[model samples]
Target chain A: MRFIDARCQLGRRCVIRENEPVTKAEILELMDRCRIERAVAYHAIAKEGDVKAGNMELLKDTEGDSRFLRQWVALPHTFGEFMSVEELLKGMKENSVSSIRMFPKTHGYSLKPYALGKFMDAMAEHKIPVFMTYNELASEDALYAMLTDYPKVNFIISDVSYREERKLFPILEHCPNFHIGTGNYVVHGGVKTMCEYFGAERMIFDTGLPTGSAAAAVSLICFAEISEEEKTLIASGNLERMLSEVEL
Target chain B: MRFFDASCRLGRPAAFGEGMPWQTDEILEIMARCHIDGALAYHIVAREGETQDGNELLLREIAQIPQLQPQWCALPATYDEFLHADALRDAMKENGVRTLRIAPKSFAHSARPYAMKELMGFAAECRVPVFFDYGEAPCDELYEICHDYPDVSFVITNTAYALNRWLGPVLDACGNLYLGTGNYVPHRGLETFCKYYAADRLVFNTNLPTGSATAAVSLVCFADISKEEKELIAHGNIERLLGEVRL
Candidate 1:
């Protein structure tokens, strides 16, 4: 079965000193080796560098690569460097971007509704899928508040740990629009159990490439005890649908 | 590909009602479905109840299944309800059990060199592989134990990812020390580990019923290492370790 890596990073993360920097070629080579036909990639430079410059670099690096889908990261409109909500949304639509990841903690901003009022409004109106790292959405109370406040925007939790079911289960139960990437969701029988509860449509494959094992994540979904149909949805169907159905 | 799971539990859990309840029959059935050839299992009761009862139950429950190898939990020497070093060794010989596991945190005992000198010495002499969970024995404490007893084959199970820095020195210094793959996913880690250390240091484990057997198996089966290394990790290394048990 083919796979689409919904979560991947380009460039190098400064925090990790041991691993070598991942280039666009290596990411593609890894995809071919692992049988992942496509990927949604974010620039690691954005984690610590200026978000605007990082996103631009990501665009330039992936300019001709159709297999590599672009994932832009942003701070709130509170940070004027990215500009007004309308303009940012317009730019993303022009670029055919389906998703935007947030690094409120790393970039030093707040994801609270008040701080990102216009940004959240734009996301909800366009039905854009917003990805947030575990550090940014650390508290369930805060997550619950954000989900309740913006019901239309699709929230995809990224870089979640394997042992996050205790916290993730409750949020999954409460929010309908909430989705999770499979980068670190390594609970025993987690996929089968989650499919039983919420169905396979709520999950997507994310290898957390460059920082996580692509082979491990891909084979995790492949070896899951769930049905072949559910595996397809998780492997690539759901992500493909989400990307295709993005309301521009 | 066949897998030999090094860390797994059978029967009902004593606490931490997170994982689904499992028994020997259920674990075996799951293994059959997942293509795991065999498993070394410890009973949860041993972890939660007295060591004597847990070991007895483990032996009895796993006796009927040829694919299951029972592991005895090590208790402190001062504890009367549990067997001391010599008696425990005798029991293991009689029961045909070769592997040993410890839960120092749950038993509320320190695994410091001073606390476990006698048992550690016997384990080293027996060439038995003693398994310790990540938190059960702190990295520094384990380093000291491995240093003190180089003859003993100390196996650390369920090490968290991103602990290469902590494990690097330990792996470099201790040839007798081994790591199980129950929770040892570290991003191209298998290859990187093989690059730094020999492939024989890794043993196949799933920490099953508590962890995903499929996830654990898939990590090794899909790793970019050679077929020989994969074979070694899958079952050969663990098979060799278990074969050295005299009893």
Candidate 2:
């Protein structure tokens, strides 16, 4: 089966938990063992206070590789690091950065429209999808403002808490452009609800590896008892569309 | 090269995230994909509040199986349903339910030393081992129970959480405690579990058809240790433990 790991924190294994290190090479080899065809990995560099540098390192590792392409997780908040969209676009073309990840809560920026409006405009102009991290709808108007402004730019919401799941649907209904990524959560009945509500089309498989595993994500999708075809979509097809829509 | 999927959950598979049904054929296929020899599956049927119904169904299914050894779940709240001691023994023993699970959290009962002692004495007298549900932060009483009765063995799932805070203490308290490689916290913490304790105390578990076979295999492959240790934790230890249970 061809599988793509849609999300990861470290490029290589580096104690994603406390002391469990998994290098990038180790990750690929493990994916190979799991029959995974391709995987999209990132540096949890935002947590390090150097988002672009982290993404640059991520791009550097995947520069020559055809199988493992790069997905840049940028902190729009970390704009002092980059002065121009030209450099950002150049990085995307040269380094193959497919998506930009936003951490409104993690970075402590108001995900409110007034705070993110100009940022989303910048992201839309560059034509990169903004992957939102662990969300709380408390900032709904601000988040939706970006969605309406950059409806073309994919808004992928993530870290959907496994406990309070019903909130995702209404939030999803309002933000038509938002897709969900199930990261490191193990609450009961979360995935079943996602497959049931989103029809597996909007739901993409992500294991939050190092913190979790690609096999965990895939097995979760597979164990949902959704048809194998639905599993294919959750594991691969939805991600393919995300990249395809971004014209990557 | 056999597997004992000590982390099997019998309810709807999607409840845990894996969408596959918890049926036997699905399990056999999963074990096959990962080169698993065999699995000892446990069912989680508390959604309808009938943990025993889940056990009965599992026992009926694995009655004659040489591969699938049903690790039965023990819900003390259901004691009244058992009615008599012999009837309870038949329910546990007749259809191949050897290992009994102590899911205190699921039962919503804070574990007590005496409660576990009484229950474990029952299981041990019946010649069955007690395997606790795979949780990291087991209540104070559960530990008390283990310390009180060393003869009873345990299969601790989610050892990552358990080890994070109490690695040294947990290992110190129960030498007989074994780990089930389900969805534990740090994927490779088993290395520490085996290193601190003995590899003999660790078990090869997938929580399969539900837990990631590939991920479980990955932890075995990527863990920073020797092939000897890996062999023991991945296969040998579980085999030895199951053998002790006369499986």
Candidate 3:
């Protein structure tokens, strides 16, 4: 089964399995071993606490890789896109990069709807998919309300733990643009439950390995009691749709 | 091979993770996959929200499934338990059980050490190991209780995430305390846990259904350790320490 991971981390802190840097080849090789086809890669910890620096590092490694769709990290709000949002978008176009991811917990920023209001506006205007780190369901509701109103924008949240996800049940039945990464740890019959609640279309297979969760998520994906269609949707289809949207 | 699972739950709620109740079928499947010969399962969280009755519900299940050995739930700070430790002792003896499990979070060791002490004294006399679930337990006095009673054995769950700078002192001070691999999430020191704590002192457990059984077992069974150490931690050491002939 082809798997498109929504959560794959970059840099050398807890990303490596045995205290070594993760080479892209080794990563893809493992993906093949685990049956993951492609993934959107992000920087680890948002770079020296400077998200722009993190974006640079993320872009640096994944820029030329065909298997990965590089998710950029920046809030041109503070880092002020090297020129303007237009110039930044143009540069990302030139670099063949696709989306922007925000790490509120690790980035030390407030993702309260009011906080991300303007950033959400700018991304919506440009048709950019905003990747959010796992905050909480209550907060996700606030973000989801805004993004759902803006039909052009899609937001993906990753790193949610098992408990934080239970709070999502009420809202998951309603919202569609919001995608959650399975790096959320064990949700009990996590993969099974997610497939039941939302078709595998929204689910993304990720290995927040070494630091995130056990390297067991891939196995969970393999073992989840769901159809091949749902597995393909989680493993690759949704990410393909997102990557195709940000075509260079 | 006598199997005693210091950590096992039957009706693992969804909030804990995504799964239906770990009915006997699920347990048997996990047993086949992980090669857990037998388990002394405890229902960690009770839907009824009452400790003794929740224990009763679990015990009732154990009664039906003769393959499962019931280790009664021991949530301290119960006024009834405070008054009736003798009755509790008698009940356990009648059941032919060797251990009583307690979630330290339920007892709040920092706020009430006296109650914890009383419970410890009672368990020591009963000759049953008291299991404590220690995920983000945030307790210092609980360690003090373990230090105070060298003869009493306490099972500390979630040791994988329990380390901080304070770990060195905690490890040095804890004697009768043993470790359980209860964290569903993997940690950095897990492979080292078996070696540093020694296989003799740790039990192979998964806060199953909530946590991945395959993940926890894979970490220990395939760790960069010897086969003897693996077998010892896998089933032998827990058997020796608990002294129960697991069915």
Q: Write the per-residue lDDT of candidate 2 for residues A87-109, one digit (tens) a residue.
A: 66666776677777656455433
> Could you tell me every candidate's TM-score relative to the true structure?
0.51, 0.46, 0.46
Candidate 1: clashing pairs of residues:
none
Better of 2 and 3 by lDDT: 3
Which segments of model 1 are wrong by more than 4 Å? A1-248, B15-21
lDDT by residue (tens digit), candidate 2, B7-123 = 555445435554664667776777777777766666656323566777776766766656777776665544475324456576655565667776776676555554444565665
Pairs of residues clashing in candidate 3? A3-A235, A4-A235, A187-B17, A187-B18, A188-B17, A188-B18, A189-B18, A189-B19, B2-B246, B5-B40
Q: How well is candidate 1 docked (DockQ)?
A: 0.01
Best candidate (score: lDDT):
1
User: What is the DockQ for all candidates, taken in turn?
Assistant: 0.01, 0.01, 0.01
Once fitted onto the true fold, the runs of candidate 2 whose alpha carbons sit more than 4 angstroms away are A1-248, B11-18, B46-48, B63-65, B77-79, B83-86, B136-142, B185-188
Across A139-185, the per-residue lDDT of candidate 1 in tens digits comes to 77777778888888888887777787888788889899888888788
List candidate 3 stretches off by more than 4 Å: A1-248, B1-4, B12-17, B44-48, B81-83, B107-112, B139-142, B161-164, B184-191, B244-247
lDDT preference between candidates 1 and 3, better one: 1
**Fnat of all models, as shown:** 0.00, 0.00, 0.00
